[model samples]
Target: MRLKGNLSQIKNSRDNQNVDVELYIDKIEYITNKKDGRYTQPFEFVDELDTPLVLTGDCLARVQDKHLEEGEFAYQVYDKVEGEYVLNPDKYLELTVAYDFDADLTILTAAYYTVTVSNEEFKDIKAERSKEKKQKKGKGRKGRS
Candidate 1:
């Protein structure tokens, strides 16, 4: 139910204004009831952005146009299970959101279909090179102890 990610205005190959939205999904937790068997379970999206990006009418229009031309922004949803961001096999989620040029990014409806990437695939999404540790030279006497 919660959406967290970066949304910005960028120029496409044609030099036209386009909106770029990428989410940094934290988790979608299940609310349980102990007393009775729960039938309806609701979830919410978490806002993990430090500083929100502002959307302009022109930008929003362009985004909509782009969406119509291409498709909705596919997002990768990650669920924090135990201590890691695990992926839910469910490929699509409905989220309704509004990008206001004058206000902080907020979801107006919370219902939009978004594509997701699995945890295993996410690791390969952005591979970072591990830094090699520097080996220390022995301080003992070079010729004698």
Candidate 2:
């Protein structure tokens, strides 16, 4: 499976030090072996900033009687950054996943999860917006773009 999306933002979770990053997959394509049980996929990552970012995770798969187990899969991203590799958790990131499957199914199945980091200025702005929206009563607004 291939994923394409923007690295929305990095937000602090329960602990102010730990950040949770959001990624959106815009498009996914299936390539190769369209007739057989294999699946080929292509995807692109949309970055908010014009810089290089890194994403790291472990691949997982489980099959039971020719069927995949649902919700029993997860890809945990340990680090994500731009320009240089940093250990800090407060950063913004986005990425894409492309995969090939050698099975009898026309479509391949997979899941992805990520963490991200961003600069201080972007972080503050995101934080302020989050606060403002929460302060409102109704469902704030609609459609950012």
Candidate 3:
């Protein structure tokens, strides 16, 4: 899913400098399901930047550890420049929120993204199977008697 928004403000404190942005959810709950009387929802968030931003570092401050089934989750921040596009592994952070299904609580899946790009170029490209390939028939046939 894609989100569109602006970098409203930036806060620089004694501890650290954080960025504040806003984004609109074009599609919500893209992945989610209810199994065995439990509900799980997956959400994604992306930030659109007017100016190119560099990712120095990333860290997972906190993660939920209750009411969620064991699963792997990943989060990343991307930089789409005019000439090149790149993904920073150092900035690409991930966290796994796990919980036993037998627990009484429920697990909620969510993600946040910070994208720094000069402009918005919304392009939808879909890959389709080529029709040039032909199906092969069975080999070593006609072995009847």
Candidate 4:
């Protein structure tokens, strides 16, 4: 499974002494399974991140871009059938992404999310990240393009 997204928020690290322990919140802009190609499959990150999760991919979701036929929409969990980055209308997926600094962001973890859960949970989690980001702003963290 390969995911492309932006770091939308953060929870910071629970441990302050260790700068490596920091949270990077993300919004998944594009997702694909290189192995399956056509069929959507579950991706497990149990061995990869501080928070482990399983995601159900939507294989039929197809869209031209974020803008739908109706209006603008940022579609997540896109299935690459013949071309790339498409979404199945009925099929649903939401991911809250984070980083694995050890791998220099080569590895990432995405926790499953729902609209209801995010509204309440995001406020609590984002607060934690604010402090850490400020404290370590000019420390050792490198920028990514």
Candidate 5:
């Protein structure tokens, strides 16, 4: 099943402690039905190079806004490792809440980036930046009025 819609930003009902942002459910492709009764959905991360990650959750969240309008869901991807969250260098998936009238829904979005350099190259780049910062610290505008 494919579902698409725009949701007004509001507070997330599943977790009321956090505020939900408005976002669009561009496309949602249903993968399979699990024996536990949850649906499997594919989520791909560009850098992982592994198969798409399957996710299942109740994306529907309650919102206070009632006016009929179209909006988008706010989302951010993170890599959780050893109980610490870090910004993923590649693509990641995040299920977000969206509301339409009295109905709640889920939206899937994919983010990606191209990295041409290797890890060693990145280290050299950082070293150059540190060197440049040191150089600039000792040099100031001599004729500043």
Candidate 6:
């Protein structure tokens, strides 16, 4: 499934480079047959070149949010070496009572999101950021009367 999310960060891709902006859905899973087990375990989104697609940062954060909304089940954790997303329960959230734990269990969960930007859109965002950066740099040299 193409899980849509907001963009968090991009690595390696540089200006003047024609990067193919690839996105991937590692896989999704549920515990106890929630939604009749709609997701497949270890789903792969690979290109014809065998390069696997990946999700990171905010992209993963969105996945966690989806799991919480579904049934507070598993989470998608990305493995950099494997270049895949793994569904894990260690990071899942709980809706139990406030005093159900030993006072050391963390109830506050952190989430993230990521989105793919088209090459044209990427250029636009880069240009706007460049303009803002130039303006900020110029502000440091002004003299008061």
Best-matching candidate per TM-score: 6
Consecutive 10-residue window with the lowest summed lDDT within model 4: 9-18
lDDT of 6 by residue, 39-122 (tens): 633321111222334443421322334534532323333333364345442333222112225764333232222223444554
| Candidate 3 minimal-lDDT segment of 10 residues | 122-131
Q: What's the C-alpha lDDT at position 121 in model 1? A: 38
Put down candidate 1 lDDT per residue, 2-54, tens digits, no spaces. Answer: 33333333222211223244433333322222223556433322222234323
Error of 1 at 74 (Å): 3.8
Best by lDDT, which number? 5
Estimate the TM-score of every prediction: 0.24, 0.21, 0.20, 0.23, 0.25, 0.27
lDDT for each residue of candidate 4 in 41-70, tens digit (9 for 90 to 100): 533211223333333222212223543333
Deviation (Å) of 70 in candidate 6? 16
Write model 3 residue lDDT over 1-145, tens digit each, in one string: 2212222122111111222232222221111122334654332223333343333222122233355345534444434456444554434323233445788432323333332221122111101111111222334365679
Candidate 6: minimum summed lDDT over ten consecutive residues — where?
10-19
Structural RMSD, model 4: 19.8
Quote the RMSD, in angstroms, for model 5: 18.5
Model 5: per-residue lDDT, tens digit, 27-142? 32222222344754432212232233322112334333445234433333334468555544332233332444555445433322223344455455546656776777769847
Cα RMSD for candidate 6?
20.0
Estimate the lDDT of model 2: 0.31
lDDT of each: 0.34, 0.31, 0.30, 0.35, 0.36, 0.34
Worst 10-residue lDDT window, candidate 1: 127-136
Checking candidate 5 for backbone clashes, the offending pairs are: 9-22, 22-72, 22-73, 23-72, 23-73, 24-72, 24-73
Candidate 2 wrong stretches, greater than 4 Å: 1-71, 80-103, 106-145
For all candidates, the clash counts are: 10, 9, 0, 7, 7, 9
Q: What RMSD value applies to candidate 3?
A: 16.0
Name the weakest run of 10 consecutive residues (lDDT summed) in model 5: 42-51
